[model samples]
Target: MNRRAFATLDRPYKNKTTLDLLNSLAVMKFSKIKPLVSAFPTLINMNNNAVNCLIKKTLFPVFCGGETIKQTIPTMRKFRESNIKTVLALAIEADVDELERKGTDAVSYTRKMVDDLKVCIDGASKFSDNFMAVKFTALVPPGLLKRWSFNLKKLQDHFELVSTDGLLSRSNVSLVQDAFPNLDASIFDKCDELSFSDITAAVSIFGPNAHQLILNDPLSVDADDIETFQLLLNEIKDICEYAQQKKVNLIMDAEHDYFTPAIDDIIIGLARKYPQGFIYQTYQMYLKTGFERMKRDLLRLEKEGVAMGVKLVRGAYMDHERHYAKMNGLASPINETLKQTNDQYNAAVEYLIANNVPLFIASHNEDSIAKACKLIGPNSNVRFGQLMGMQDSITFKLAQGGYNVYKYVPYGPVPVVMQYLYRRAQENREMMNRLDKDKRYILTELKTRSLFK
Candidate 1:
């Protein structure tokens, strides 16, 4: 693609000043951290107003729709007209209510967002099989996971209590007695048969970490939790169905390692139930085990007779992962070097593109994307994705070259954008450190753009 088309991907603005400032601020914001920044409140307060102003004045025009629904369509339309796909995401994360409420709200928001996107996509026929990206945390609820972890601790305490007390009274250990009746009934036979009130009192008074203990027990899957998950799956299925009917493809993003296993379980289960290529799971090639995991996932999907959709990213959580590992004296999950990450990322892309699974390459690197163009044979199922504000040169040029391309457009309130921008800035800075040449190129590009007539 020529620079003209590359420039049009970031259309609507008459000049490059906003985009230039956005890029410059992004460079500064990621590397700046305060001691009090450990808490979300401080971080939000520090950059919330300024970042929001930057977002509205610069990044939003370049990366997002307006803060509201009506504002997003025009941006989506511009890409659609250029034969590029647009993935709309509503960025909402908070320390609010429990998981069920959050999941419900996320589902509601997704439905609304999809409905809004459909009006433009249907009219223009420019959207792919999915028009939006979904965050699992948005649907699963943070508190549920927290509560689940808490319940595991409680279960461990319950185990300790029963081992010592030996079921002296129903009030003291009846739940265990009921849960494991075969474990020496003689220890409880002589014990008093406590009344319901006594049992409740004992549990309420002694089982302080009841939730945590329950979470520890692998067998402690609550029907309510399962039902809540079922609701999320149903909602996802609804979205997938709508996407399929409308020819949109929804790509599931890769999150932190702590949450990814559950996301994997959900995606695998859904793939088994739905054979279509509507859903995709992400693989960050930088991890040591990502390629193995991807190979296994592909095999599992093939065995289950489902079309696999895969997204390849270089990863966003390396610094946090490495820092935590160092603090705790544990081995890190991140690739030891950027070269390793690049190698793995490109290999995974080759695997998926070669395998004929519907694939999306989400990266900022030119070499890896060029590898994709070479590997994507005739009739290949692939799309390249890049963030709306970052890496314009690649996305626009790829779109111009006639390869499938999509812009990841994030939209929402100012506070949320602050969080997102912080992460983006951090990731870009890390990438700069890892790939020094790329940073030099960015400097050169900024200079060239400044001088461009």
Candidate 2:
């Protein structure tokens, strides 16, 4: 790939005033300072008044779409003009206090979240066929998921024993009986009837040492936990239905490993139910098992006649995952080296293209992007994606080259998205360095324009 082909400073900055260009350069230069401020709470609060003013003028415009969907339309239009698309993401973190207050009676909370998500979908759909990305954790309470995951782990252990015994019965009645001896038999009858053959087939698909039968749509949680699980599913189903009705694609954001299995189960279930590529699950390539998981999921969906949609990403949550693994004394699930991650990521791109799976190749790395561009055919259902503020060069160049490209534009209240901003800064150091390079290009452009005038 020609590095010069990816140079996009002038084209991306065409709408910007000289001050806007300089301010963006200043923000990138000062990106390191925000992490320092975040580390010291006292310092952050003490200088909030001034810092907020500075952030609004500099950081906010570059990164976020806007505080609300209506406010984001103009930015979306700008991307359209550049022959790029927008995946408007609502960056609201889950409110723990509100979820706790709703407690077991989450009807009101569920309704509110669905309503809010519908607004985001409706607003985003106006700009493109691809719509908003919603964090499942934002819609469902993390505590409820934690409780469900805890119980599901026990159920998985029991199923593992059953799988070891090699029983191939008409229904999972035997597995359920052994797994939940305490629960009513009626509940087992009520659970989705998966035969022993189905279990064996799924296990074969997932390969050895995979979590056993935890992918059961309504996982075998306790009676009380069932209500919360159903409620969460109902919210997801509602949002997905609305998205489908609007002819918009919904991308479910992946969370930590603890929550990923359940999230995957929900997304796969939705994919099977809705079919026709309405929903996509994100795969984080940094995980050691990510390629295997993606391969298994694609095969499973293919067998079920469900059209699979995917967004491939280099995993976030690396620091948190490593810390959690070390604290628990479990083997870290992530790739041990950057090279391993890059290799797996590129391989995943190959697999998706070869399998003819619809994919969003979400990366800022030029090498990866160029590799994907080479593999993608004229009729390939693939698109390049970069985050809103960063990677302007890569995003614009891909568009200029006639490849489908998108910006993951996040929008929410500033205070609520502070963590989002910090993560963006931390995760995109290479892009930050590129921004330093971009500053020189911008300066050169400014000088040329001045001389021409």
Candidate 3:
């Protein structure tokens, strides 16, 4: 191994010049709008065959390793030789039945991938850097989980209401309004004849005696909702433990605020159980409150005496979150401006490094990556990560500069690949109104490459 590239580490990425350049580029308006206008239509109609065609041809090649395991090999090999780590994910997201079907598919696919990567790692110990990443929503439907959570809250509120008094007060009405804001006027008119228990029984979707309602898409087996989630956890755990034996990492992708706490708790529990090798918990830096949340988690972890592993992202669901909040006249989770997000991202990176916690700073932003590299010192555990296709220049250059870097390499067929593609397109478009640094960096790279020729 040529250690020369990895040796000249300190004082290499620390200069403030590129950071300032990035700041100027990031604040410009036209650089942001161009990509937005181009990406919006494709994003809005993600299900369109034409869009899928484009995704398969252009974006997939850029953002994903490939559509199949065999296809991912070459890309994986290239990264392996370069000493860049890889996190392979079978990109699948759909409704309940489809998600469950794909969960089985993922298990089968991951086992094969694990076997292959193990061989590669064994053959060339320092070469292969492959791990597995999966989304929770890929194994279970998001809406079903949402409905389950909603029903649970409703039952709790009803319990409180009945225990208080015979009359339903404003707070109890608020609870009902929160769950079913579109409650029928006719339903309200008939409430006068119903007692607390009668109303509770009437409102119950699965009858009052049952502790929980059947999820929108009920499980085929005797697996309860939490049990089903536990099964998913067990599958990932089985794979993670196997991979750990082979020196591979497993990461859980983050979801929306609604379900993230449950998922976070699960990941944290796993991290505690397998502290030496298993690292979990993901952070979305694009959220307005992301920094605060990270700080809170850091304190909690410190108090609990557990190591924290995080996969940091600029987030992808800002538009949908904002749109939903605006429609419902509520606050959104997204940052107020691009500067705020970038600042927090940088701060969070610094925070992680200061605590000496291992982190994966998965992003395409040059300034953010540069800042992280500077903060990492000579030999640190921070890894720079990027999606396979979107920003190879940064990924390659950072890896070339001797920092540990990883590519989020996703693989699967077209149908399952669509969800990953949709998110990539949406993320690019959403950031278009926010950050211009990536576009500007690309333009600079193109100019430099032309000049070199």
Q: What's the candidate order when arranged by decreasing TM-score?
A: 2, 1, 3
Better of 1 and 2 by TM-score: 2
Ranking by lDDT: 2, 1, 3
For model 3, residues 1-453, the per-residue Cα lDDT tens digits are 322343243332122134333333333332246665456455545667776675566555656667667677777786766667787777754443344323454556445544544443343233344557756565444544454445544544554565455455433454544444433324435454333343333433232222333333332112254444433455556655766776666678877655554455456556666777346567888787678667766665665577767778888777667887798797887889888888888888888889888788888787787667667766677777887645555665676676788878777666567656666665655556323434455446544545223
TM-score of each: 0.68, 0.82, 0.66
Winner on lDDT (2 vs 3): 2
lDDT of candidate 3 at residue 115, scale 0 to 100: 55
Off by over 4 Å in 1: 1-43, 46-51, 93-130, 143-224, 326-330, 433-453
Worst 10-residue lDDT window, candidate 3? 7-16
Model 3 quality (TM-score): 0.66
Which segments of candidate 3 are over 4 A away from where they belong?
A: 1-54, 95-127, 141-144, 147-223, 230-233, 430-453
Candidate 2 weakest lDDT stretch, 10 residues: 203-212
The parts of candidate 2 lying over 4 Å away from their true place are 1-17, 33-51, 95-104, 151-221, 430-441, 451-453
Candidate 1, run of 10 with poorest lDDT: 204-213
The CA lDDT at 239 in model 3 is 51
lDDT of 2 by residue, 1-453 (tens): 222344333455554467656666676676657565355334334457677666567678889988888788888897888878989888865532334423346656777878988888888888656657888777666655554455444655565566545343335455555654443333234335443334433332123212333333443333444455555566767888898888788888877776776566667777877898968899999998789778877887787788978999998778779998999898998999989999999999998999899999999777898788778776879978999877776787787777788989898776667667766766655356666665665666566668324
The CA lDDT at 11 in model 1 is 28
